[model samples]
Target: MKRLHAPAICSWGHFYIGVRNLMKNPGTGKYAASLTCTLLLAGMACVALGTFFYFYRVKPAATAGVLNNIDWGWELSYHLPYVLISMGAFSCLFSLVLRKIDFSGYERPDVWLLSLIFITLLFYSISSQIRFLDNDEYEHLHNAWMMKEHTIPFFSLHFKHSPLLEWITVFFMSLQNPSTLIIRTMRLFIFLLSCGSLCVIYLIARNVFNSYRTALVSVWIVLCNFVWMEKSPEIRPDNLMVFFCLLAFLALIRFHETQRSRYIFLFVLGSLLSFLGKQNAAIFIFSIGLVVFRHVLGSLRTRRFGIILITTGITITALAVLMIPHDIILDIGFKHLIPNDNKFWPTRFLYKILEKNPEIFLLFVAQIFLFKKIKTSHPIFKEYILSVSIVALAFLFLMNRPWMQEMIVMTVFMTLLAADALSRLFRKTGVIICTLILLAMAIPANRRLIKKYIVKKTMTRDLITTETILKISGKNDLVFDSYGKPIFRHHPLEPRYLMYFPEKFSRLELLEKSRTKFLIKDSYYPRLPQKTIHWFENNFRKTKKDPNIYVRDMAGRK
Candidate 1:
């Protein structure tokens, strides 16, 4: 017994020593393996939690936008399975692609990434909790449902706008459950795709720069504490447009690097899809041109191949121009260029100024400092200068007005630059020091804000529950609420602004066209001007007690 115990003890001691040695001196391969396993476990946990939440909460209430009081041929039970399938399939697709990414040296992303992710999750959580019942999302869903059920989306199927988003909306509406959780889950799905695109951008940048730190910085910037990430979960076209635009950007960058014709086609296709996503895609088209200006300027300087690339672009532009009808070409002028002063000009300009003043000033300062450093140190300084110049010029020209829509796009570009600036500045000052300062600033800033307003005024007090809106909105009802409007309304049935398109014509006309029956409004939200309140009150029957909600008569006779 003593002899056997000695051999066993020696073997066990050797095994423990071997394990300790592996842990102590993990080579690159071993480190990579460990990182991979850790990530897999983390991802599995996230999926499990997200999935459980989605099924138990999201699936039941998502159909509030489209299926509230409206019965479709599909069984309510089928939706959970469909959503599960969609989510599962999407996750598998992501896993396949993400598994290929070798996150070898990048260990800890700094506070910015963590902060951005935290802010994004919080913002989306807040927006998702509001539900889309009385939001613009409901109207969009209503229109999409109309398209599927009646063969027309925005009035009789003959509407001019492309049905790209509408088609997707209708597809989801077909699997209706009227659950807030479901609607949020759907938006979350898209947001995750956008996150994936950001990861792709990171990989591309890493490959091009051959610097893990730079790539991580770029990812942090892309997913920075920007407004859009928080707003993306609210059922809007911007999220979809951003995803497509980023895809196009990534493809174009790939093409620029590798000179691959397939990548060029992908760029064009993505740009096209982006255009189909939102009317503001013209900005993306313009951005693409600026990127191509890289080639033009290069050709001009080096005489590598002058005018040939420009000519090809012109040919493609001509083809695209030919696709649009003469009527639309004419309409663009009357509709957009010659804005009615009373209706759009003053408000738009003021909005632009308010939205851009701080960002523009800050970015200008950053550009001045960053350009000097970038010129001296960056490997791609030449390209950076050219790209920065293009972006600056576009920013100058396109920030023509301060509409909320434009502000979002502007924020997207500026936030990235800000992130870049912060990353560079912090690197120069030491990561640990900068991180401590940032945390110090963030905690106090958040605390001060919470104390000064959030707690004192009970601002979040009006953060209405989905149950409230559900009680107010019925089938065929139209909700008229802005993006930041109070949560509680007549019933938790109407889609708010974030859930719907921000366009004036699109929301009202599309609702009427879809034969919507009820309308709800909250007067407490100060964003609603007196004129807007009067208009809603004029159209719908006033509630006896609450000025906040206006109810529309279903029989078309208020």
Candidate 2:
């Protein structure tokens, strides 16, 4: 008989009322709010001072005009301090605002945040697609062209790294009309792989943390990282390798969750694919194998443990046998694992790490405050830390090349840990703060990237200049230059010879005696001997309008 009225939904009204009540209270709630504000302000001040010291005192002194010759008294004194202060202030304010909002009740906000991240990263990647390729990218593209033209057999580059990336480039180049579009098309494909890697990172974080919010926050942190942003969209094997490496980690996580033999097989498959993408992926593959081995040992009492071991053994052995001929099995040993004088010093590598990703460095400092929480949280957390440390140490002691790119896998691990630390320590507020801090730190690097790659347009200039020179030169004529080797290799107007400026100038007479016609010299080179410069100036007429190029026709003159 009684008509029951369901309560009308008034979420916003309730929130308003709660805020008013807290404002009115003079007891613990108000005090707690005031204390939080004080702590936030204090933290911001400390960040401002630390950043100031780092840039003004530490950085300039360390580099000492080697790479940074900017007037620090004016630039660092004004612009940098202003930026750092603004960033610190903005982060604190943003965190305060985020602390009031309850994101847990709605799924839409999380989806919106994740979509924003994806879009931002996609835009950056698209911008980078048209930008110039890196030196390593150029080398890979040249090698791919060599294979496509039958100048070199397939899998020639596979001995050093892997041929899969080059083969893919060749396939895409085959679709396009002009060979120059090969780099652009390959960049687009690499962009997709980068997106895949981002997705895998999200999935792994979600699985490990069991929270979509945390995972989304993790992805945001990673997207804000300059190294990830810079390296992801480039035409290089590292992007493909990183994607498969993340996929392998995802499979490992799934195996841990479900105790499934299929997931183990998937892990093995992913690891092999990653190795095929780049030999450096062996570091990640071995780390995952260790995790799997640990899992197997832990589950020794279970009935399926033996089956797991047998399947894993079979899969690994099969992969090893298949990779032996390709040289992937011994690649790491031959390249990085052997100790050499060129090995990067651990201290210097650590400094470079801080120099490259200051945001990660900041978050690492934040992680120190949350060390107790992280230590008590999960076994997998310790495993990640240990694995990253091991890989980083290995890189420091053994790797001859620049270890920055190789540390990307370690960056992922650090990002996950940083995300987890933020979540545990400060919840939603920390997420907002950390994200803003990272973006702020990335400002200088992002500006430099845009200036160098997008605004300057040297790559396009070089490409057009090379194409023009190729059109004028005869088929049998040798084109000599230090730069644009990739362009020459791909287009092949004539057989191009790369000559080092100072190092090979002693043999300039030999090049002059040969059938070399056009000398495409970049203006960036040091001044040659006045006699040789006068000879080049007098003998060969400039062929192109590009001021950076010095094209001289050898046959028309002396």
Candidate 3:
């Protein structure tokens, strides 16, 4: 029995000749015909099944905005495909394990770990495309669209959130006018930018821990952190802010390693970008300042380092003053830099960690106790993350709420600390404990990814209402949109905003009296008050074409 040659196995002749031999058997003729017929039937059944669902079952549900309800046909057509794809994924993973791939050319386990990270995040990036604007992205996307149309942030629009992320979104959006593809495309782009941040995390940890395994663990911990899972995938400014902070942190690390004056310039640029993303990122700058101060004090014997730091800071400050527009400066002074709630935010940082990422919280506690015991390649590494984490937590007290959204800061550095702690325990205490901890992170993540993405898919965003409104209303019509339903129309006045207004006056009368053209009432969680909802029901006409749309009834109004 001769073993098959590699070329003989792979060549086209192998498949062609095997088929010829099978046909020559004469015994398999009827069976092969039946198999081919079965294959044909399977292929044809796809179309038959789709037609049946479309004509009879799924289409019965009126498509006003999103399908009014999810039915059996809807589940089969939408979800079943993802289920099949997931099955294929598991089969591939099983095959990878069974057939040990070559690793001799690969130098270390970092490659394996990095590969795992890549695949996991790639899944997330792709999976994110299926989701809607689940968070503040409703307003953010609208603001970006407005910015694309040359509306100035903070001055022209009532937007106080970060500007750079919106500007970045504008850059992508310029390519195409996607009525609703905006969320999916922007989310994908954000996920890509977030990947760069992950790289920085891995590199920073690798330098600090002096071990690729620990660094990889750090990256994975951040990825699996419940906060990260919720936030990182969204089209949000905070993701960009975190990315920019990591960039600045990376620059600082490089400057320390090489003692180059150029890295200082890069650090300045990253901090500026971070600030442009959000002013609350001041904590990141504070951490960078702490590192800079340490560098200055550490090298006090040599005045050269101190001189470089001062010169760079002055230069960057001057450049910022010159380059920033007058409007932006005014905005920074009026809203961003100066105004605060004066009221302290709910002290929920501990609770958020407990509810969302308990694994990280527990490991963080362990790291605090075992700080003296953990070994790192760089001595400053210990001080670097610690100072940053402390400043971030302290800054949270200073920065509770700028607007509707609460601040989530310093999570990246905290995750690194937690991962390093877990690595230390694994090295000393053993693998079993670490494995359980990993499971705690991985299992929930698995269920979430499977259920949300594969099971039902997040369809909270759509253009049905927007298209409907555009069809019905005049160009100047005011809209009551909560989730950016009407892109080109006026900014959707929120029932929440009637509530979200800082003033004591009730703007609820605007809904009753103001010539509000349309109200989008849908599953995207429009914050309509009971009275406003009743007003819409009585005063506005709900079209059968789109039940989600409430048109202004000027004819019926006295």
Candidate 4:
């Protein structure tokens, strides 16, 4: 027996030696050099294209404010050149660095890539701190304040959305005074969560595609998205939901691969947390359930019935333990889903795709065409497609319109799928080209985001107008403004006024009812009657802050 095995062992040893020598051979450097040159040339070409577009297309749009147009088609077309150029430049540069740059005895490439993503997201998140709170943010701030002040019970906050966001906000507000700075604090928390989600996206991509580069590409796609950039830093539940959803998916993938009870426990934990973050996260939970069902069915073919059955039992038990409380919370908070009666849901969806996220939309279309090329047998592929379909269909049924924020679950799956499809379709060089192009297309939206959040110091005219009113009014003064209750709630001023429609109520009627000391009006309200305007001008001293805002003090004679 020993004599018979010796020849085979010797042959294997010789084969290993030959392979080792081949790897160490000097000739391979030539291939690396050639690849490096190719990448460098690509990068130079991209830079040239980016320069051209920056000058011709992006610069003009920036100057003309055409990028802010409501017409999706015109906006997309106008920004296409810049998008192409930016994407090209990015691809070219990335390829060159990957191929030519060497960092021996340092952090692995994957670690470096993740670090880069972390830094980029961190910078963006910090930049977002300066952004003025939008309407939804102000509403969240009000709710959080209410919760903090014990005006509303933590469990009984009647917001139709998930309570986790409010809970988190309240928790943070407890640590500090609830002021304008609370807005920044909440945003910072959300940004941190968003960064975590990005990391999870990279991990999930790496697990599914088994390539660091693919994972980096997946993250890059997400990073380039204007919606993600704008929304991630807002005081909202979407980023938190994305964070937990990505964790749940990551755990699901691990469970599938390892068949471990611990992963199942984690998956359940993540799913529950995700659901708490946003009620819509149930879509991801349902998708995970479908994947488990598919796996159970597959196990029957492989004759692992007993093992699969036990796994399924453990998964179900874990889910039940977490889901019981989740369901109760959701049942209490659940309200009517906002409906879009426009009957043009598909058209609006298409318009959003064209207007805001053309690059992602195109990649999705490309993914469809290249579906056959994607391995159908792969669990990640099957799970992602199934999950995306389930969520998208549910969203369509519930809201008709493809509301972008509501579609975050679908977006994550689609982003991963897009990454996978891109990997299959393009080699390293090609991947860079495709990535940069998509990124460049998204540049216009990002430019607008930068301008709105980063560059601009002054608030919107409406906000400035409102702030002026808040600044000028006394603590005990009753100020009526067209902006409505949010300003009163946010400013914590006494004698709050609810009458926003100055057109509906006569000046005498308004003054008589509330004894309002100051009347503030902005462009947001319907036009004031001529008589009402004249009455204020004749009876009171009128002060104009800007073209948009007017203040009247009844005490001062005109």
Cα lDDT tens digits for candidate 4, 1-558? 354334434533543443344334423332334444444454455445545554555322221133122244543444334333433443344444445333231223333343345335534643555555555665566666566656566764344567788898778777864234455456556765675677688678777777656677688667766557656767777778889878877887777787898998998898888778777777777766767666667757555775777788889989886877755644644433445344335455446645776656677768677666665435455556556555655655565334556656665677776777665554544535644554464456456666766556322333444455555666445555443323334221222223334565554554545445566444434466766566656554545443433445545334
Predicted model with the maximum TM-score: 3
TM-score of 2: 0.65
C-alpha lDDT score of every prediction, in listed order: 0.47, 0.57, 0.60, 0.56
lDDT of 4 at 450: 65
Q: Write the per-residue lDDT of candidate 2 for residues 171-219, one digit (tens) a residue.
A: 8778765445565456656765666676777777777776666677677
Please give, for residues 481-537, the per-residue lDDT of candidate 1 as tens digits: 543232222222232234322232234434444433444443333444455445456
Task: Give the TM-score comparing model 3 with the true structure, all chains together.
Answer: 0.71
Quick one: ranking by TM-score, best first? 3, 2, 4, 1
Model 2 lDDT on a 0 to 1 scale: 0.57
lDDT of 3 at 116: 49
Better of 1 and 2 by lDDT: 2
Show pairs that collide, candidate 3: none
What TM-score, to 2 decimals, does candidate 4 have?
0.62
Misplaced by over 4 Å in model 4 are: 1-123, 297-346, 369-381, 400-402, 425-446, 456-524, 527-558
lDDT of candidate 4 vs native?
0.56
Runs in model 2 deviating more than 4 A are 1-112, 115-119, 157-159, 293-333, 336-352, 362-372, 375-378, 381-386, 425-453, 456-458, 473-477, 483-514, 523-541, 550-552, 555-558
Q: What is residue 497's positional error in candidate 3, in angstroms? A: 7.2
